[model samples]
Target: MDNHAITTRGLTRRFGAITAVDSVDLDIPRGGVVGIVGPNGAGKSTTIRMLLGLIEPTDGAGTVFGEPITRPKRYADRVGALIENPAFLPNISARANVQSMATLRGVPSDRVDDVLEIVGLSDRADDCVSKYSLGMKQRLGIAIALLPDPELLVLDEPTNGLDPAGIVEVRQLLRRLGDEGRTVVVSSHLLSEIEAAADYLVVIRFGKILFAGPLGDLLEQERRYVDLQPEMESEIEDLASVYTNAGYDVTIEPDTVRVVIDPVESANLNRLAIENGFVLRQLIRSNENLEDVFLRMTDANTEVAA
Candidate 1:
């Protein structure tokens, strides 16, 4: 049997004439945290809905637990998900909300308290959900998702509206969950969160996957750059031109030159700077992080289309 917790083959969804989720493929292995990141309206939520079988795809197929997604038996027992804003009875306590979901899923009653503890809401379990802050409500939603103890957990914008402390709590919880060998798929627009928490990532733009791989591999030397500062302020633009003429793509910021140098060109940059009589004050190698790459790629794509 396939060990994948989630898999999609050419999944597509459309609304009238507009394509909300284009042909997209995803494979999430069991017992790992895979992050999905994209801009607003980039189809992250649409893709999750298709995986949950809440919306049928316009074309192609997907599977959860190695069975076709359309089959409730395939996904029902193995997957727990929180997509978009989760609803709750305003008058009920946080614990009560989780217990209701556990009951609906036929999960044991004791699992309610277990999930509350996992989400760190045991102290406030008796407080009415309406009285809970936004972060508390979000944790309650997570607690509901956890109650079923499924093989896979999928959360959409799980940290939305959370304060810094709440964000840290959720991040730690996800790490703990993954360490325990549960497959996790967390979607967010926040690159920092993904960088700090996810082992693997799928970056999307305009409903299509731009890259999918290990986070470390994606941020390798080829995709990195350097920020160069010149000792002489007057020679800043001159140094930038020197780098540019040597075929390095250099962007002049207010006081530094952002240089995109490959393996071969990177070595040449240092040697050329010394030879050209420009004193290099700083040469800090920076991984043009996923966020930077996302912005650069999308902007170029937009400019080209325009």
Candidate 2:
């Protein structure tokens, strides 16, 4: 079997005059969660749809489990997907809905109980679909996907419209699934959720891939900063000049000064401040969060396009 669960090379898709997904290359491994992030209209949905064989690519090629995407049946049984909103018979019980889906897929009905337990919905298995919360409904969508015993699970904004508690619940579930060695691909607008749940990331912009790699690697690429507040507000300008002369990006505020520097240089920064007669009231290092890094990348891409 291929080590990669999914791979695409120069995959492109166009709708009339608009290119929904440009030439894109992706290599998703067989285990762990990979988060795909992009601004609206960045082609995330279009790319996923092509991978699932719901839409054909206009150029290039892709494979799922080493089988050509065009021949979906070869790998379809091993994959499960939840894209956009999950549809269910609103008036029916969750169990009945799962049973009906199982019947259509020819999946054994016995798997329904197992999937419900995996998604933490076994207790409410008999509840009417309409009565379930948004989070519970999302869990049901995931349960339906799990019925196939898929090796690869694709979820698009699984936490969309969820409350904080629901988001946490779904995040933990995805982590657990990846820990169990299942390959999971998820897309979300929630950067913090993605940072917490995904081990790897793929960032896209304007229908093009901007970045792809381990989440740690992406974070490390961003410059760290030191936030400093002097004992006297008047010293802010002098402190900014000191860091600026030392070749650092300095942001001066009324109460604090933020200096973008390597973490190792933080001690040097403090030493210079003291040497310059600036009494430091507070000095704290702040790392760039995932949202910050994501915005920086996308913004850079936008500038380049301009």
Best by lDDT: 2
Off by over 4 Å in 1: 226-246, 250-257, 262-287, 304-306
Residue 286, candidate 1: alpha-carbon lDDT = 70
Q: What TM-score does candidate 2 reach? A: 0.82
- Ten residues in a row with the worst lDDT in model 1? 261-270
lDDT per residue as tens, model 2, 16-109: 9998889999998889999999887889989999999999999999999999999998988888989978779999999999999899889988
Instruction: Name model 2 segments beyond 4 Å from true.
Output: 226-259, 263-286
The number of clashing residue pairs in each candidate reads: 0, 0
Each prediction's RMSD over C-alphas, in Å, is: 3.3, 3.6
TM-score of 1: 0.85
How many backbone clashes can be found in candidate 1?
A: 0
| Candidate 2 residue-wise lDDT at 189 | 61
